[model samples]
Target: MGVDRSMWKMNPERLQEHLQLKNRARQIPDKKKESKKRACRVSRRALPLFPSLSV
Candidate 1:
């Protein structure tokens, strides 16, 4: 037996967004990650390694 659309009440826009996000979560990232990389902290001096390149 088919359920009436009105019985299962949810905002149409919210339902669509939820479904889209659910589907998106299943897909793999574009890059095939070998492993998780450790986050490295850089000091201000290191950031401008090449001053000319910064501009």
Candidate 2:
């Protein structure tokens, strides 16, 4: 369902805030994937220094 027009008419600022939040929510996943990849690379690099850690 679409957002109700009356809601925006009642509080225009709420509509702006909702749209901003929606946009930010869309950007979060890509950042999470990049961070996970970086963590994996760091762990892989460290594993060679402590060979016992590798399985």
* Most lDDT-accurate candidate: 2
Q: Mind giving the per-residue lDDT tens digits that candidate 2 earns over 1-55?
A: 7966665564678878877887898877787788999999998887667667765
Per-prediction TM-score:
0.34, 0.37
Off by over 4 Å in 2: 1-10, 30-55
lDDT (Cα, tens digit) per residue for candidate 1, span 1-55: 6754763576888778767886797675544342332123335445667889878
Clashing pairs in 1: none
Residue 31 lDDT in candidate 1: 45
The TM-score of candidate 1 is 0.34
Candidate lDDT values, in order: 0.60, 0.79
How high is the lDDT of residue 40 in model 1? 32
lDDT of 2 at 3: 62
